[model samples]
Target: MDLFDRLQEQIGTVRLPLFAVTVTAAAQVNTPLIAILHWHGFRRATPLVLPGVEIPSRAVPGSAIQLDAPWHSFETVDAMLLDAAWQSGAWDVERVEQRGCNVIGASAAETLACRQAFGDYGEDMVRDPQLLGDETDRDGLMQLAARRGYVRWLFRPVKGGLWRTLDEPDDTLEVDGGRQPPCPVSPVPRRPGGSGRTVYRLGKVHRILLPR
Candidate 1:
């Protein structure tokens, strides 16, 4: 069984607010979603920090997402939370420290290298700067996030969303309006008799962001 299928058997349904992560060219940081998050009463900026970048709704000196590579070693559970924190910038170190977030005093230099080098997924969508730790292990982390209900929003740098409008990017993927795009990753299968759950072909590897 694939990772996605295995997760489906383990965890039934995830009840959490959709956590989204978005990275675009520096020019387009303040997109509609940022505004929308603000509109939804998310006054804090800590939730918007990702690896190598911090997307604060309102910039605050201390509220930063510190992307220390050594501190963030690659383990399935840690990787999931790291990616979620990297993607959504929602993790409060002070709050989640009880849940295994300990600062090991590593350098954010590795994190900076990733962002400066690729800055999210590069062309062909194969190489993401953030996925550098352990390519083989990412799937496990992805699955774990689903099992724990942390895989809320897997927003990539695609055709639309807040980034597109803000960047006015030329390489945006085109759509026919009727069909949705194919998922970036292959899906895991589902187990029989799963309640409140339907097996996704991509197996919920990426968080789905429904535009409201």
Candidate 2:
């Protein structure tokens, strides 16, 4: 089983807001190291600090995602409670923090490397500026990222009151009008009696399209 499978075992099918997910990542600095991806329109920026390949998010002062690694996994992430179930996405922060929120024992690092080295659109996608900087465009950053590694972290804030987490990305795999794309997501098998719990493994994607 890969990190995705192990993650589901650790934290059941609990769906959470994007904020909560980042906070949990902050708390878990060592084990199950995670690299966050903070999307900024067509511009890619570092997310809040954690560790590993650090970068700071331009959106929030701190935000980051690093799926481009091998050691990265979701294990340390435990759990927190909402003082009150979300109602229209409005609530008191003081009350919520007071009621729950595991301490961020450590913090993530601020990073711009992911954005700096690679172009905003990641057309370059080169990690090592010295060795492959010039050849990045032709060598392919996606392959370099693969050499470094990558894991697709997918989640829907509230799907049936449970956060829907998946191993792979599904947007491109679907077809609103035409037929499905060439590369379809490889799904992670579900355990016995598992309902509404499915994970799709990422397939090969050649381009690093601008993130919105």
Candidate 3:
């Protein structure tokens, strides 16, 4: 099966009556993902953590983040374009919109965003109805989130992974046979006259042979 199908099976069946999936690179070529959750009627978001999951890093080409959103939030989301925050790498971000019971949404986010967004929703700081209450402008809040570090809201939706990543392109740019993990540093060619211990980059860590 292709990568998407496996993810569907691994992700299992969710309770959302309707949801949308978009394809975005998780990181440069084969790095892990930086998924985020956007709940309806809330201005902020939390990490989209898929617990106890182990699949090939390549199997997850794009986002695995799930969002439980209301109609407004769902409609605002586009498959081609998605919401994401910069962490260290610039890659496409996949967003899923789930509308159903038993799925995590705004109520949960109010607590989750306590340290991330502001303080608690109502205790330490007052909840902004315009940002969180009915018809919540999630995009607006995320756009405003750009100002804060540690966590950034995707207005145009950008990338990063723990720390800033190299300016290399993700796996999508390469052909199937050429796909490989991102090298932290670029490989320098051997000098014309110099020889001992030439610096090199490994495209496939598992391979025993060196490329000619």
Candidate 4:
């Protein structure tokens, strides 16, 4: 099946914890994210980590580390980080959203100012009503959200080992045939014929893979 479907089969209804990773190439700035809880409110102010490439002490003001190789060495670093996260089982796919500009963990006030400066540049997917009893769930999702640029809530629903993209563009992108995973049929909701209620199959949870 496609990558999304395979993810679904792995993580059932258990909502996984969110982990955010922001990278800055030399002079470039960092992008942050926010999280949304399945049954609670938003989360922010989680311990976000920054493990950048080790560059020579003397180099361009803002250039990321570079090494001469047949292919791009940076790609190797990225793969290593992704693999590490997958093994940790603490984080899922990395969410991508457009922040006003890349700003690393400068300060809470400064970050808030930057977010306010942007003023709704990206989509906000937090639609569930703000509940008060789910402190644990809210905390986890919020930390995940803070790490991303925009809050793209990653979810893997139950039934049908299918990986579905939520509010993100997946089907529109192009990819190499050899590298692309098999796409599976998305789960369908069962029809309710005078029944009190029917269960809709949500997708599964698997590792998130960002495009190169």
Alpha-carbon shift of residue 113 in model 3 (angstroms): 6.9
lDDT of 2 by residue, 131-199 (tens): 111222312432343233222223322212122233233232222111222223222432332112233
TM-score of each: 0.19, 0.20, 0.20, 0.19
Model 4 compared with the native: what TM-score? 0.19
| 5-41 per-residue lDDT for model 3 (tens digits) | 3223433342111112222121112221222222211
For candidate 1, write residues 25-131 as lDDT tens digits: 11111111100010111334346556887554531111112122222111232233333232222212111111111125424543332232222223523522232
Error of 4 at 207 (Å): 17
The 10-residue segment with the lowest total lDDT in model 4: 59-68
Report model 2's TM-score to 2 decimal places.
Answer: 0.20
How many clashes does each candidate structure show, in the order listed?
Answer: 7, 24, 8, 27
Candidate numbers sorted by lDDT from highest down = 4, 3, 2, 1
Q: Which of 2 and 4 is the better model by lDDT?
A: 4
lDDT of 3 at 160: 13
Q: Give the worst 10-residue stretch by lDDT in candidate 2.
A: 92-101
Best by lDDT: 4
Q: Report the lDDT tens digits of candidate 4 across residue range 93-161.
A: 332223322347446653453342222112231432232232223233223334433322233221121
Model 1 residue 189 distance off true place after TM-score fit, in angstroms: 15
